[model samples]
Target chain A: MNIKVLFFGILEEIASTHEIIFSDIHDIKALEKILNNQFPDLTRYKYLISVNHEIVKNNALLKDKDEIALLPPFAGG
Target chain B: MNSKFLVSGAIQLEIVTKSIASHSNKLNIGAHSVFLGQVRNDVINRKKVRAIDYSCYQEMADKQFQKIKDMIFNKYNDLTCMHIKHSVGQVKAGEISLFVFVSSGHRIQAFKACEETVNLIKDEVPIWGKELFDDNTYNWKENK
Candidate 1:
């Protein structure tokens, strides 16, 4: 399955504001490992992953065309 | 009672002037509390901030703001109306980032409601801004 990854904050500096396709990821943790390996600089940033607008923990099932967003902590008033 | 609110990414401030005026007139409100959050040129370690890039999880931020408004309405007795506006995208130093307006039958409730709403937005909304500095360095404000 292909998953879309979104970036924000300094992460956006390292990775452009576009989604990249990852083929055949088994779980969220595995995807995280793949991303960290691909972009080692991301390991230093604090972020949260949301699958289809809902925050998920563990290896939640992902389907094609699912919108996944990576959010850095907010800093607005 | 009516609540006219707006949530958007555009730079223009939201206004519910007609609703506010009508409500205040009906309630005979005598006081209005307004808080405006303007972009500042100062950052930590004496970095001079030049601009701010604001972004938000729009769906969640809108819901959160509406919830905060409802909560304030329930907690305060004399509030006639309230409004909140937040800017997205690049905002220069000295530009207004947020504007909160509240009118009440008395001064106390208006002040309390304004304070509560601003604090709630800072604490709960999923809006993030990156500070661009004169040195061309940028930092994201992390929640503590």
Candidate 2:
């Protein structure tokens, strides 16, 4: 299953890119581990994970073509 | 024209004026509330802030705007109309970045809806602002 991952705010700066594709990732926890291993700085800051535009409080199961986003603390007015 | 949610640059005074004038003919709207958010010029580490470069997750932002508008209207059924516009690109310090307009039959409803809309947008919107300093440095803004 191909999954699309998105990075926003400071997370985007740490990831060095806005998006990436992952294959074989079964859940958010697994995705986190892989991303942490690849981009160690990403683990330093707190962020929220959203699966298919919905914020997930816990590990969420990922499906094919699912879009995942890592959101930093929002700074809007 | 840009979408209803995101404006490409600073919210123009003319647009705000037009928005208010457009509702003038509606005899039922006895009250109109307007909220404007301006970019602050701050000195961080002795560097002055030049502008704010705003960005967001567009697809999700649109969804959140719709949700907020629907909820606000449902709660204040007497509201005649509501409009929201937020800046997306570089907005200089001292310029308007956010605008919320609400019109209702009574003063209470318009005031309440406008305040709630501004607060909710600040918290729930997926927008991010990078504070660009005059000394070629930057930091992220923290909403208070």
- TM-score of the second chain, each candidate in turn, equals 0.81, 0.96
Whole-model alpha-carbon lDDT for candidate 2: 0.91
Clashing pairs in 2: none
Docking class of 1: medium
lDDT of 2 by residue, B111-140 (tens): 999999999998888999999998778998
Q: Report how closely model 1 matches the true complex, as a DockQ value.
A: 0.51
Q: How do the residues B18-97 of candidate 1 rate in per-residue lDDT, one tens digit apiece? A: 44555654647888888878887876788888888787777666777888899999999898778787877788888777
iRMSD, model 1, in Å? 2.0
lDDT tens digits, residue span A1-77, model 1? 67777776667777765467777876688888888898888898887777876667567777776667677777876
Per-residue lDDT value at A41 in model 2: 92
TM-scores for candidates 1 onward, in order: 0.74, 0.97
Q: Name the regions of candidate 2 deviating beyond 4 angstroms.
A: none
